[model samples]
Target: MEHMEQYSITIDGRTLTAWEGQTIMEAAHDAGIYVPHLCYLRGLVPFGSCRVCTVKADGRFVSACTQPVTPKMTIENDSEELLDLRRSLIEMLFVEGNHFCMFCEKSGNCELQAIAYRLGISAPRHDYQFPERRLDASHPDIFLDMNRCILCARCVRASRDLDGKGCFDFVGRGRGRRIAVNAEARLSDTVVDVTDEAIDVCPVGAILKKRVGFKVPIGRRTYDLEPIGSDLEARRRPRAAAPTGGAS
Candidate 1:
């Protein structure tokens, strides 16, 4: 396929050009506009459920990842209206489930945590729905905690696309919906390969290394990188591991 040419786009009255076929977020990132995002990963397809990256393009608040650019498209990435919308979305994420970042192992290194900080959401404005969930520490290398999962599906995609192992899937719907390993089976027994890619693909600490916990401090953590794309690309490196035991 031919390389797509750069096209002009006006976001927040600033006109800039970006390569065709790149998502709105990619274009904005190239133009030095940081769109608040949580579910977006560099090497995977954009799943916009987190809604923090919504931008007002052509008078509609659409996800920058799912929405492609068009000629003469004007977007408002940081207007007061969209900022309020983003704040509300971040608040929803905080109250939807157990996102206790302060206690999470991936607090400083988490995308959701970073976006929540960027949105200035000090605390959840809505009621907290702390549902009961079981933690899966059966895997020798990693721990799968349902409590911190926001159903971003980045790990699922990483398993399928990058690792060639479709190990993760969303089981149930709405409040009942959670990422399950191996068609509702245990993570240790899943036929899919659980490489370092699977672990790093997670936006939160839902899937974490078993032995290594909080080795890096908050301020010196990986999220300190200016553009998240470079960090994400670096994390996608697949590390060699011994044969994993049965799925948990």
Candidate 2:
């Protein structure tokens, strides 16, 4: 692999080095900082749909996933204001989509749920939208439940970019937006396979394999083990304190 140039950037109070063209989130991740995000997966291109990764860069708020870092850039993450904003956004998602998380299959494994837990969002402050949604179980091996969908575009990007099949896409506009398969009306008409990345990439219970009764017992799932971003936080190699001059 070619060596990319690196430089320094400040987050909160600490300074760290980052790749030349990496997004702010990427740089922060490399430095063991966990910026909460939903639409920014590691491998696929960074989609800034979910603004939960918002940060203050040089005093201007920006999405860390899409905002590329610059030399000497100073970023504000985990501030009280930013935390409240993220918490509010998460709460809105919960109420807008009727995310009855307690009964949802993706409760523990869902990124939305995990992020909400990490942000200490016990309940949303907004009124529930209760938008009516559809559910499709026409496929023999897959199920589509729009109720759990956050419209993060992970499935759309995965299907088109990684799987090389433009099976999943968005239809409608504004609050009427939804995931639409290339099929005539249902996923059974599309060429989506059980093993496709699109099926596996859904961060919520929206897209799931059929006939696989929840095998993983509760209390052992992904977020159940730890709060979201704990893995990256663990990856951080603690910086040793600077040496005191002559023991003062």
Candidate 3:
């Protein structure tokens, strides 16, 4: 078999090697560089709905999650301009929905909250749009709270692509957009299970598993001990030597 050619790109002055077909975000993650994102899951298709991953590549701003890397390409991810853009996006999400992270079950483990914290967004700059969204608790083991949704479509993609069940989809348009189950009836009538990838793919508290709220307790959840990008930082760090013999 012939070997595929590997090339390098310069991201924020750091040269990193990348494969031919890999996107900028994928290459950055593989190189232990954290690029903030909401809709770009590792296995799922890059939805690029959330513009949080926007970065300047070769002086052109583009969604890093969907933009492929080219050799010697100049990608600026950590620039002040890009960081401000990400912060603004996070802030917009906060105001667009009723994301009361303090009272939500997915607070600490929520990707939206984690990203907001990472971007230093203490509050939304824009006025809150506390739209009157509905909550569907008819499901036996799950709850769908539209108020907290960011419309990232992670659930929609996961349901259609991974679950083999087109149970979820985006309905309406613009400010009226929402996720709708195929049943068109109550959520209990739908075929979605608690174990569905769609449930796991939700970035916020919009879709939650019932009867397990506060199970881990506050200040002890996923992002409690460390920030969202801490894992990437750890991966970038050099590993210490292992002792040849048993512990002293």
Candidate 4:
């Protein structure tokens, strides 16, 4: 295999190296630069559905998860305009769904909630839809709460690509769109299991494992100690060098 040439691009005035054919999100993540996103998992194909990873590059706003990084490209991610856009998007997600993080099991571990905290969104700026949604607890080991779904399709892709089960999919168009199991009758009739990757990749509290609610305790969950981008920022720090020339 031929070695891909590496080049550098400037993001927020910081020069970061990236390889050819790599998307801006991929390059940024590999360089340990945090770019807030949903509907984009590391190993999964970029869906670009959420539009939360939007960043301005050379005066044009583009989805960082899908746009390829080019040499000499100047990307702007921390500007006030971008921050406001992100906040508005987060707020929209809040109102579109019945998050109710206070009572949800995935509250502390939810990426959506963490992103909301990171963007300083104390409340939804938009009107709440309060759509009447349903919950499916037919499965013995897993359940689905349609109310909390952001329709990011993480589970859809995970089930299709990773699990090879094609157990889940989106049914309906536009306002009526939603995640549906293959059986369509009930979750208990499907082949999905508790160990499926789809059960774990949900950004919101839509899909969850059963019988383990509140196991970690409140205020002691994944994002309770640190915000979403904290780990990415920590990854950006330089590591200590290993001792050389064997034991002295």
Q: Report RMSD (Å) for each prediction in the order shown.
A: 8.0, 6.4, 6.5, 5.8
The segments of candidate 4 whose C-alpha lies over 4 angstroms from its true place after superposition are: 237-248
lDDT of 3 at 222: 93
Number of the predicted model whose lDDT against the real structure is largest:
2
Report the candidate with higher TM-score, 1 versus 2.
Answer: 2
What is candidate 1's lDDT per residue for 128-204, written digit by digit as tens?
88788879887777798888888888888888878888788788987789888884557778764445587777878
On residues 24-127, what C-alpha lDDT tens digit does candidate 2 reach at each position? Answer: 88778877899999887877777899899999999999999888888899999989999999999888888878687777777789999999889988878999
Local lDDT at 42 for model 4: 80
**Model 4 lDDT tens row, 95-198:** 98888987999989999999999988898879999999999999998989999999898999999999999888989998899888899588889899999999
lDDT of 3 by residue, 1-248 (tens): 23444667888898877766678887787777899999888878888899999999999989988888788899999989999999999999898889887688898999999998888888889999889999999999999999998888998899999998888888899888888888966788888999999999988999999988999977789999898988986776222122111111
Estimated TM-score per prediction?
0.86, 0.93, 0.93, 0.93
Candidate 2 residue 118 C-alpha distance from true site, Å: 0.9
lDDT of 3 at 178: 87
The deviation in Å at residue 28 for candidate 1 is 0.9
lDDT of 2 at 184: 85
